[model samples]
Target chain A: MTLRANNIEHFYGSEHILHNISLEIMPKKITAIIGESGSGKTTLLAILSSLLKPTRGTIYYDDILLSNIKNIDLFRKKNIGFVFQFHYLIDYLTLKENIALGALKESDNIEELIKTLGISNLANRYGNEVSGGERQRAAIARALVNSPSFVFADEPTGNLDTKNAIGVFELFRNFKDTSFIVATHDKKIIDYADIIIEMEDGYVKNISSQRT
Target chain B: MITPLKALRKNKFKTALIFFSMVVAISAIFLISAISNGIVGMYSTMLKTDGDIIVTQRGIADTFFSDINYTIKKRIEKISNVKEVNALILGAAPVDNLPIVGIYGVSENRFDSYKLISGIYPKSNEVIMGQKIYKMLNSPKKIVISKKEFNVSGVFKSKIGFEDGGVVMRLDDGSKIFHKSTSIFLVSLKDIESKNTITDINHLNSDIEAKTTDNFIDNYNQFKIIKTSSDVISALAFLMGVLGIVSMMSMVVNDRKVEFGIMRSVGLPSKTIIIKLVAETIIIAIFAYIFALALSYIVLEIIQNTQKFQGYINGEITFSLGALIFFTSVLMAIVGTLLPAIWASRVDPMSLILRGAY
Candidate 1:
């Protein structure tokens, strides 16, 4: 539940993406990782969420280091979920089936989840057939289907208007037991997050806490 | 696995192309291999006769062209363990417009192998036409060989391709027409287990060679060449099949790298992804192979019915041959899917997202 990164640095070829970055994400709390374009927010999110291994340093879920866990995919399958800026749903799959892909068991309540995401009428529709806002909501539903402890979102609202963007953030707040790490450039996230980690040029410039 | 099938169904065009490629590859392999198997089967059936050993003159490329004194049969009969000696005169003579009709001349008692369908065995100066050749030539009352006319006394059928496609006559008539002492001497041993009799008979004359029918069929230069060619051709066809699958699967996986990346990000294990791809390939491969089998059967039926291939082959795919084809096809399918799955698994998951659909 508590996610920790220690001196995580990454590079793509000769270019450095993230400097020595370290942070702790509290359990059941909303954490926002904010930075300008090309500031390495997505890269850091990628490393922490097990999408990519860091070039240097470590990430830990509670006390267990990432390298110590043998099957990373299975580990992620059970405890972690991911949502991307593009609402990366398989175009060939129906909306309900796409969400069910993340479900680890038959008892994950797919119908209720679809209703919660307010995509019940579009459950049988192909991923490509839904509106952008509805697709993002379905994406969020997918990330929560397995009741994973942590859900990582990278620019989930980049293409959305103010109302849709707010709707997306509201879903994150409503999912009570699931911790969310959102990497974005949106200023609106600051009002909803319990912790704010602002990044500049791949370095963690500031870490602030705000709770209602 | 079900999701992958759904995906294939969704992209029906791509799936169909892969399916067609697989079908063509498998069908080509089975059809060519069947021809190869047919040659061996034909020879084996032809040689299953009462005579256990064959004696022909040394240094001959064409077995029927070999010549030795017919009197050598008496000397060979006198050898220890030699039960009987039968002299045979063999040659090829053109009939009507058909070139190279095989001709067989045997001693009086050697006609048991022929199934007499319509008439008795041939007498001196007379000929019994093979059933197929008789019907094919429209049942002529007389035929010509070496400018000599012989009355067609009866019709007989022998499943052996060379015999069924030609004519049989008495040894005296054949010797006079062919102008040779004899082409071959077939020997039957008292005890078939007596292997030394062949060597002893071989030493009797310097100009002639004797070998057991099994040894001759296996070691004959021409038969060896056919076997080797069949093996090489079948192996090459299977290799090309594997390569075709590899190429098709490579394109499929390459095109879906982003999709795989998303799947991985959603926590689908690389092993599961691999299993799915292999499963999909096997389904297509099995279906294609079954379809190819049906196609091959239709082609074989046409060959069996056609005038060109009658008596040459039975147009059969044996049990072992079918199983060999099936296993090779499945192996090709698995190998083809595995390579691409491995490449997809190693691809950076987030890189696909950042660089692709994002």
Candidate 2:
């Protein structure tokens, strides 16, 4: 059982944003939706992530439809996680507390996860005291805290410098068993995806699969 | 709760700005209400100091304008439990640069109620001025009332504001000048039938009201007017305070839209967002109420010391009024956050990213 989007169409007050989108998200794989600004890639990611409902379509999580879930927030809490371009960490909270904010339930693996992300020491500092790369790493830790089945990221490395941008993609590469649907304009993201979805002007221009 | 508190702590300047606004607005509300209550209180105390049951014409806004025919005093004097009925006339006139001077016209027998500090009791057209008023006039030998000249015979002292800064004259002389009215009758209640005295006097005439000195302000028409106006203004002041809080809290929520978007994306429920906003706003309101209470005391002090309100209105310091302010402040905080919370919780995470919030 996996996620599927069927006959998805979206409009912004008569301005079409997405067109007849149908796709299946593979389990335990990295999928990149890459396009230029205004290409509607982020909107598609929003629809897939439960942050939005398409104008004409149904999203299915395995055998259950998204609409039938009744409590979208509860469903999202149980199975989904998200990271945005800017690491909107609450500045007053320490990085560790910020990560703990996303926990669906208490888990003993948090310390190990922080170590894996290479931010174990940085976790105790306030969010404002940390460097950009450190804060983004904390954001990533926050997203994975729940051990969700799907992690949706919208331009996760958009605010980073060149070195830190590469580091973010490397972090995604290390999480092979977690399904990631990342939307971005960065060409560097191409190397890390098991499947690449190319969007152009509210349409999917191409979808390519590469095991390598 | 910790998250909300931490958020407020981090935005120190903004939180302080919110607190200051609430304090000022709530203080204004407290002042208006207190002054109104105080004016009623001061007048009641002053009017009741030397009298037991006071009688005045019904529907008269001012005691000076209340007309109970001179002959009515005879009927009240005959009532059971009535020891003495003093005919007192109250009026105001301008003297020199001073705009308002209180004038009391009392019969010869009631002269003892006012202590004569110097000289003799007023004779015929002569008048005695209050020590405070005498000093302000630089010891004038004569004062004018209703454009009539009268000699100032002596200086007197009184605790009541009406008499402390006023003139006292013979009842006959006052009637000749003020004309066409008898202001009030002060009834001295005998111990045994004091309760029935007021009821007996009120039954004599439908045009006049008779109440114990303690309940005089409650029945006075002028006091009713003051009370009604203060209620309206206080309500408006509180509304403005609530609106101020709403505007400030809404802007705070707007500034955190990016953070709220992220919280929503991470599957934080709308309920949690509401709780945070409620917690933060209520905390601010509580602090504001405390500050406003202190500020109100200072404001009342300044008003009391000022020449304009010095003798008349002293702000009523009551536990019930303080409690009223506290409850209203909490209500203001809750109502102020309601809209912002809903808006924050419903924020579109995708729209925020596209709009450059994240």
Candidate 3:
């Protein structure tokens, strides 16, 4: 699947945050969006994830316009996943319940995903009781537990230490069948990507292929 | 919904505060209703007597203002079924700074209901006192009534509280002191034709009002007015309880803004979020009612055991009254919670996420 945004613009009140941005994201490939703080990377990511509507321009998923999708929630649930900067796990629920929340069908590989994330032992612990890195891993597991075709992550490793950050990126690389769109300032994430889009002043300054 | 319940359990103090608020409001209402009913019961007991018929001024419920003329009494005595007729002079006077002490003067012929416990039958310058009045006067041998020094000829015990702290004097002496002709006429019938005597007396004169004891009880305006006014006040209190819940539930809904946002972000639709909030509120309502009833019952038991309200509330808390109050509280909880819960469901998910609320 290919997700495309053309001339996307977003405004917060009177201030223009994103200006005439366009990008193409492909399936089974890692796309990195890198920018400084307040450069609107998060807003652009949100617009692309179908969570927010752009003030101008259009977004298409496999040539199907996102605005035309009548039930956007159902589409996002089945096709796209989101990993926020904060884990956003319900504190009352155990890690396993949080991860399995994305599993709409019984066939979804929840237990295997928990094992792959090496959080099988931490499954019964609440979000507040677990370590930060483990919660981030559980969040990742949550995004992938539904077997979504694409996952959008905003600074997934921003709170993780060097060792844990490397582990998260490596885990992202292991998803051979899932596409990723990651917004980050981490050099490690940039190096691990198949394509990099550098954003400056709310514009896409450069898009380079690194998969050769 | 389960998660909301878990959150409530974790916030134990908050749960307790909400529960206590409900308990206080419900119990306050229950106590008011019980006391009102108690007073009504005491009034009914005081009015029970052997007299079959009573005659007074038309449309007058209070005997203090209700005067049956001597002519009317004589006419009622001539009625065929009438066996005996006794007139009473009712008044209130301050005796030794005790303002509004009930004073009733009856003919010596029908003084069977009240017996002298201490001295003798009250003569012209003598008075019989209830135990409460005797205590108030410090059991004085000589007591002043209506500015005239009189000897305390006797002390009597009456079941009615009003009569218990009152004075009774001879009819001629009462007439000169209170300056009343006659307040009421009590009539006894030869047989079971008490109803016919009342109709015949009323027919003799349009200014005369006559009724059997049962009829008088049913038509008494004081009891009817008090009952109606208390019920209205009880309803208002219930409304206030509902408003209390509205304010509390609104605060709860506002405090969970972040939680609702996160649920929406997880692809849980607004309907599901609303369902969870409603379910959580309903659970709280049911639990609060159970707790309130239990607490109220315990408090009522403690009160019934105490000397403060011992004579008043002899009967247990009536079941229908308690049930009505509980039903109103449940209504208050549901109506109060539903509006705010629906509003919480419409909260913007992106704003909460962007603000880093979760």
- Per-model DockQ: 0.63, 0.63, 0.33
Per-residue lDDT tens digits for candidate 3, residues A96-206, read 988866467663588899999999999999999989899999989888877778898989989999899888889988888889899999986688899999999899999
Each candidate's lDDT (Cα)? 0.83, 0.82, 0.77
> Candidate 2 — which residues are off by over 4 angstroms?
A161-163, A173-177, B50-52, B58-61, B69-78, B83-86, B107-164, B167-177, B188-196, B203-208, B211-216, B356-358
For candidate 3 chain A, the 10 contiguous residues with the lowest summed lDDT are: A99-108
* Segments in model 3 whose C-alpha atoms lie over 4 Å from true places: A1-8, A20-24, A50-80, A100-108, A173-178, A207-209, B37-57, B60-204, B208-255, B294-317, B356-358
Clashing pairs in 2: none
Best by DockQ: 2
lDDT of 1 by residue, B1-358 (tens): 6776887887677678778878887888788778767766666555546568888898776567799988888888888898887777878888765666778888876887778888778887789988878877888888888788888888887766667777999989989978888888778888987579988888888999888878777777776777788778877776777777788888888677777878888788888778878888888888888998899888877775566553555455888988998988888789877888887787768876665554
- TM-score of structure candidate 3: 0.73
C-alpha root-mean-square deviation, candidate 2? 3.5
Docking class of 3: acceptable
Q: For residue A193, give model 1's deviation from the true position in Å.
A: 2.9
Q: Compared with the true structure, what per-residue lDDT tens digits does model 3 show for residues B136-215?
A: 66888887777888788889877655566778888878888877778877787899667677789889888778888667
DockQ comparison, 1 vs 3, better candidate: 1
What TM-score is obtained for chain B in each of the predicted models?
0.88, 0.82, 0.71
- Each model's number of backbone clashes? 0, 0, 0
